[model samples]
Target: MVNDPHALHHRLVDRPRLTGLAFAPDGTRLVASVQTLDDEGTRYVPELWEVDPAGERDARLVTGSRRGDFAPAFAADGTLLFLSDRDPQDPPGPALWALPGNGEADRIAHHPGGLTAFAAASRASTLAWTAALMPGAKDPDTHAALLHERDRARVTAVLYEATPTRADGMDLGPAEPHTFVLRGDAPPVDAGAQGLAGAGDMALSPDGSLVAYTRAPTSTAPDTNVVVIADASTGEERRTFSRPGHQYYVPAFTADGTRLICQRLREETYDSEWQVTLVALDPESGEETDLLPDFDNWPWPGRVLPSPVPGDTTLWFTGDERGHRPVFRRDPDGTVTRLTASGAYTSLCVTPDGTGLYALRSALDSPPRAVRLDAGKPDQEPVLLRAPGDLGPLPGTLTEVRTTGDDGFGLRAWLVVPEDTGPGNPAPLLVEAHGGPQGSWSDWPWQWNPWPFVARGYAVLLPDPALSSGYGQRMQERGRGQYGGRPYRDVIALTDAALARDDLDAGRTALAGWSYGGYLANCAATRTDRFRALVSHAGLWNLEAFEGETDMHTYFREIFGDPRTRRERYEADSPHLDAENLMTPMLIVHSGKDYRVPTSQSMALHHDLRRQGVPAKFLYFPEEGHGIDAPNHLRLVYETALNFLDHHVRGEEWRRPGLL
Candidate 1:
């Protein structure tokens, strides 16, 4: 078995990734979405897998098809329902499918623009999902006809009256996303227009009387969201709850159906660190209460899980702290207790009796795997459940490092070093900055794994600098509206501290980052010549241009305080301003469809590097967006990145990446 870090591509491309976990109504069985690369290695083939939560049986495949299935949920009647794009009889678009426990899956309902999300009620067996409805096309048939006509004519241009003309990983809309309800076997019922264009996070009440979802009221500032509660039968809005300058998402109702719990973030600024808190709101009275008033840790910002125990006032959540994303529980009295010790957990599900809690756990050293935890015992360790396959061993080991930043703030980082490195044979360092600028390096990253570099004999530094969560509100506040200031210094401080160790070599080091980290890498290239090489993937170049071209223009406008008024910020933080100072051999990677950072950013940087007579190479992926996902493309990404670092940092002969 090839378990080496450089050979991780083999494992990553072939290994089945588990996600979107859901528990049965009785909690006896668990179903999850397992995605693997297809035979041609062009796209992922997702299938539903069933696992016996009792640990008596190994996980087994439940559903399979070429188009794939995902988002599995059990209806109140023990019928399994999922979203799929596998209807050969019809043109490919996600449609609702049902599995009657003992029979083959059957298509239940079809949506023309495809279903973006789905939700099911636990008690009433009611279903709700979101689908894009084209303007002037009131029904699915009309929308389908419009889509077919557009495709037949090969028309690609889209007319836009909206602020966001396009989005990442999705085509621009001549249509708006609306919610619909599936009732028995009758034709699907239109739930009316969800005023907010792209409504998501649909949740049905336990009694199936109400449907609650989150959506941004306007297209300009799509980040700002509000929760809407509507009558399930008529699809008429009963009430809407939102706080000014706050974003609400993942709204779930309490067992008694009086209150809705959701993750809420107060929009302090455009670039403010998101310190998400769980808030409970009375759907009727619009009264809101912060469940964790004094808790400083930022809750996990990815997917929100429903309350572990129904009818219980206590709520369980996950948060980042120190260097770990741990499970936490907030009692009815607002007292918070930490549960798991040192790993990241997501897709949480609890037994009906609340005795057992199950989640997909992951860490720096491990990929996501099924695990069971004792919900009642906070101190008990989680037991790993049998997954589809096993990852035998790791080629490297991870250690935690701490240092004081320039501003006296404590900094933490995860250092992944190959087992072969020691005092006698120190490894070259690769300082990796995480994205989000507000995000942390607490969890295992599948897209940008560090093992490949370790396998290539280079130590990887995963730093959580200023603007990183898990450190508390103050740590987050330090990087507000100043991405290149404190955060940059924090990363350098940590790198310097790590270099002081005997196992790491300071003379041969490189810096790499993606997204905001990519922005930081660009900033580092201009600010310092400390590293031998640098890699910037989907990084930001010109602040003013980025703000204008980015999908979230309003958010950027708020973050930088209007480029016209804050010209100083735009000039000071933008990497292009200091491009002439870049001295390191840099590799720039970007995708044509990356609307988040935009490919123009990379193109600008490449032009500057060429004009300045700097050694630079641009690896452009026309088919990818934000990040590379296709198997062959991913292989080229890692091989090129590693080869670049080997040539510059390790003084190895340059070998151009294969299949490029």
Candidate 2:
């Protein structure tokens, strides 16, 4: 039950709720992007904040436009390089911009291919970035491209290099695009399969001749055969080593450039069993050794581990192998030493000198706060940094639960019961499923469904079914091809078990999810008309059509199997095939700008439901994409969904005027 507003996880929301925090070149100021949700609820802006580790609020508003800016990096000349969607000439996509640290900024380059600025470079007067090539751009889909697409329409990704200006201050002709694919029509990437694998964070070696990056198998098949290495000077790729059964997230070069230190995920979960490993790579020899192979992996699934101390071979990172993920150090001798011990930590960044560790720490009941960790003694407490506006403790109760599915597989979930739920009356149940059939929602702050549902006298069920991360490798890979088969069965089994209890309202059950969960909701609607009402966000309809339009069609075809080849299987499992069976009145939410699942899927379903005379309404958020980011839009979405559920399920007349 969430009585405290911050009942989810303390470290997740704690003050100086640091995001996109980067250290300046001289380590003078820590630049971070702070998300502030305003009063009107329409404008949620993330402003640039610069704070001196010693507690200075020199935070300036670098981004002045209506569009959001984040992922700031300080260039060699002290100019700030960042990603923004405010380019005057381009559509709503990330573009590289250079802003003077002291004065007004100017546009550097406009990527026609769309922005995927995972990494950028600026040395002397030259500026470079790694991005995706747009369709119909230069011949980027040549043999040397990393992305392998079966069809051009469905292929939305291609690696590119952008050179803003040469070292001589002269504009370097035009952007040079290079596809990482093999030469000459090798075969397009399979649908539902990974084309070319890539690294999230990349680093240019000190010499600038070699590029070091993390290489994970592009496919989501749990190919731990991934590792970080440097591209050879001969234009050949030299793999350092393979790290099977683990994920290598962020990579950085050592000061010497001969070795690479990367943040490796030891487990999918963040709690007691999770571990973050710091591995050292010998680029020249193509060899790698885990500095701490036996280290305990933390429960934080997506948080990046801090790179090892700049010049030191002994890697230092913040992880809680002892309890929660806390700071720890690994000696060259493989002896794992625990660092910061007290509160739960979610994210941290260490300076190049290792003198200070900027961390975001929170307790079970406390919101996360920024702290500067000084490597001294265990008894030495960290210096508290910034304290944003206070959001008093949430009014709720948080309980961790472990439930097993029909297959007897262990499922981990959180049950948030409202503080107002008394012993006599069983609270209405609302089951919230996470997206990313491959993504996990563990230790995540309650922003939308769970929090709001609990506030309205509903118990939220967040079950980490077989496919969710945080458990282990096997758990995540369990429901791969069993999309509508096992996973759906698991959900029903879990719900049935829960409904059997006298504490939950069996007649008022409501199901909700986004992306993959949307697909699941579609399945639930058609497979069984158990729920009184349904809420689907960006739901996927017509998997057959999706295979042809989705960017990763090749990959999807592989997993779901080319629906054409396996038409029977596809139809039998796809919600679109059995849509006629759906009897529940459902509200479908979608963003017109969505590319991952596309708006067409939703449109098709809406039209069909209307034609069939089924109770269905489609809500389109034109100004948004995938998920609603604007505060006003978010409020509208949440309020509309709740009103719909209350009217249809709770038997309450809560619809506002002109809601349709």
Identify the leading candidate in terms of lDDT: 1
**Prediction 1 TM-score vs. true:** 0.95
- The TM-score values for the models, in the order shown, are 0.95, 0.70
What tens-digit string does per-residue lDDT give for candidate 2 at 1-660? 222323332212333334556665566767666676554434555556666677755445554423367777776566777777776663435666777766656666544454454343323233334444433333334421323332445654334342112211112222232212111123211111011333334665544445545443433443353553434233345554565556676666665566767766644321112245566778777777666555334333234343334455555555422123456655556675656656555556666666667766654334556678865345345677764533455556766456577667876555677775654788787877778675554433433446666666787777666566445545545565666777777666667666666667787888888888888888888877778888888778888898777654544665666565678756766788776776888888988667677888888878767767877877788867767766546555666777777777788875752434
> Candidate 2 at residue 127, lDDT?
35
Q: Global CA lDDT of candidate 2, please?
A: 0.58
Estimate the TM-score for candidate 2.
0.70
The per-model lDDT (C-alpha) reads 0.80, 0.58
lDDT of 1: 0.80
